[model samples]
Target: MAGTVAATLLVVVAAYRFRSSRQDRSLPARAALPGNVNQQLSGYTFTRSEGGRRIFTVRAVRTVALKQGGTTELEDVVVDVFGREGDRHDVLRTGLAEYNPQSGNFSSRGSVEIELNADPPPGGSNGRQPAYLETSNVTFRQQGSLVVSDAPVRFRAGPVSGSALGMTYATKDGWVELEKDVRVELQPAAQNVTLAAHDPKSTIPFKATAGPGLEAGVVWLTAQRLRYDKDSREVALRGPVELTQGNRRIVAGRGTVFLDSRNRLTEMLLEDGVHGFETTDNSSMSSAERAALRASPSSEPALAHSTQSGPPAHGTESVPWLPGSEVQRERGPLPEALEASAQRARGIFDPASGQLRKLVAEGGFQADSRRGGGDRKQPSVSRLEAEQFEMTFEGVHSEPRSGVASGNVRLSVNSSATSVAPKAVRGGRPPEAKTARATVKVQPATQTETMTAAEMTFDFRAVGRSLKRAQTVGAGKL
Candidate 1:
């Protein structure tokens, strides 16, 4: 979408070039001319203006008339769009092209290159690379103000770069469409500093390196097709859509990206069977199990007083657990990976930081995790399902701080370790003497715990993002 806008601008340049030639009597017609049968012209230059302001200028090094009233072959074409505006100086260059006056169709014979934001702002292009769009074999329909190409289109602006199989741009309608195989990558790049920011204290601003809103990581997006509606400021991608950033990945049937007027990213909405997960070495588990693990140990007096309880807590431990030592070992390690799915998900962004602020998922939302690492003999699995899930993030890393699940929530945890029964103590005289009482015996048991409620809210620890507190709303059963 970013590159398509530049391609549309280049189309205007091509249209104006032909219009200027027709007005200058340079176009070949059925009527005979002063030159020979095979007439060739060089150093052709034309400029179009309105209201005493120059709009565009076109220059061609060589031109040849193919037939009496057929096509005109042009080579080494250069166009400057909005030259009089001073603020915007978009330039287009192409090796060869052809124009048909009767059909009002101009087509490029070779590769075409367009440079956007060519004229740097006062402080400079903010040390940012100029945005460029490159493609081959494109046709410009002057009658409709449209540009299209069957060849691959590639573009890069600031931190974003992408390629598409085919492209269509409707200048009049203010939209661009990619036919198929759309792939885009966004690496952290400095944005507003160059275009909008300035250092007041110094004569020259420092070289800007910080990203506009995205984190200092690489993100990739792939889709079957994409369309950008300039007037609506929306970019819609046809699924199956896959997005990957760092260890996190999200997939959906479709997605829409919203942009502000300045072309800054604002929000992204994914719908139709959205699923996301983290790819990491650590195993994943649901927050319900984690909350039970952390809260139940302290609440159970038997485990607290039992000698077999887990190791003592230390100040240096990042993840703290209160269960008995044996229980801790049996439970293994806390899960570090997470997986979530829903029918629809929406992500709202923080404009200033360019980071995700909140995420809302609805329609049979479910999150689950499994713990496979640590000292335990077997892995533990946990799951939580609900009608809706919402989470809000905080900090520069965009860590999740809080989450809520509402409407018919179900939480379950399954531990795959052997049960440990408390040891029975015996006195020296217990066996033979009737006065001595017999020690009570208990049986070992393993069980899976499940709880259901109408709503659940979880507050996470800031550092490790573990469940700090959990509360339920409505009658809950375990």
Candidate 2:
């Protein structure tokens, strides 16, 4: 988008100079030619200056008059726009270009290439590349400050790259719209590259990552259309937007991303039926390995299950869950995977660290998770549903520390149980079970628990790599 903006600036400069040269006599004089034959000139140069500083320069190797219409054709044209502070060097190059002062129209006959923020620092690019754009058949309507291209366009800016069927830029309104079949790719790196008229100091250091489990992979985005607002520094996508990184995926009807002046990602919002899935590195851990880890001497004591009639205490009872924690410690900590759906979803990020700070979901929000390595037939499941849900994260690992759910919140947990007998009985009292690995004494059955409340706050504690306990609030009941 920044590259397109540079191209728009170039067009505006060229169009103004063309009109100025035709009417104003102060510009360099054109070569004299026969009245009957078409006029021709070589080595054309034009410069626009402001406050004793050169703002831009336009140069062409050859210029010819078109006989049919009052149009001028320029060959091997180059347009350079030096930013106001003299810190930016943007250039536009085209094999041939045409301008008509009478119609207020400007266009390129051949492929156009644009380089934005091409000025490297004192030490050079340092293995990095500047923002670049390639497109053909571009037209500018000078009267409207609009630039449009019917042909396909491709661009690369820092760690971002993409292509689109067509594009339009409204210079006056400070916006750019990519017309159809928009596809964007993000590479994981420290993106400090300068863009457009924004200064180098304004460029934020951004490290791209899809999510916790997808840190090593690149992110991909596909949408039918995309729009960028310069003033707001927002990118909006329409028509079933999908973003993916490795095994993690998010889909939505529409999405928007906000960035600060330094190009730091601040927030992302998705609306109209949003769905997401996340998996951790432990997703592939084997049941035996998980159980071994939990059984290690250094691990905390496992929560014991009750075969008695009464349900477990609120928030304190161990809920045998899956994909993250097991129904039984002997079954192992569940491989971490999360699935969520909502009418809308929003993500907030820390501008300085480029890490996710919080996540929010609202309107028919539901989340389901299960631990792996349990009984194949009846796996443990944990689910939470609410009108709205919000989660906060902490540390460099992006660990989720707490969450809140409001408006008819419900939490359900179901687990499979194996009846076990104690190794010894105590003086006429029922046999006491010591460990989850006790001898089987009765039939296997399913255990289920449900909690409901108007609002619920969960304070999460980490037990090794698994979620241990959640303290609920707002009069939640079992």
Show how many residue pairs clash in every candidate, following the order shown: 8, 8
TM-score of each: 0.64, 0.64
The whole-model C-alpha lDDT of candidate 2 against the native structure comes to 0.66
- Give the Cα lDDT of each candidate: 0.66, 0.66
- Model 1 lDDT tens row, 1-478: 9799999999999999989988889756666654533667887676656577665566789987676667777789886665334334556688888766578566895888766445543445523234466778888786665678899888765456788898886644556788899888765434333433542221221333545534325567888999876557788999888876654667789999997755567799999988786523323334644343333111221212234344344211112223444544655563445678899999998765667889999999988765553453345657899999999998765788999999999998876645434344566543445433543434323358898999999898987766688778777888
TM-score, predicted candidate 2 vs. hidden true structure? 0.64
lDDT of 2 at 328: 34
Report residue 59 deviation for candidate 1 (angstroms).
5.2
Identify the runs in model 1 with alpha carbons over 4 angstroms from their true place. Answer: 1-38, 42-62, 78-92, 115-131, 189-216, 280-335, 372-376, 420-446
Kindly report which residue stretches of model 2 are placed more than 4 angstroms away from their true locations once superposed: 1-37, 43-61, 78-91, 115-131, 189-217, 281-336, 373-375, 395-397, 419-444, 459-465
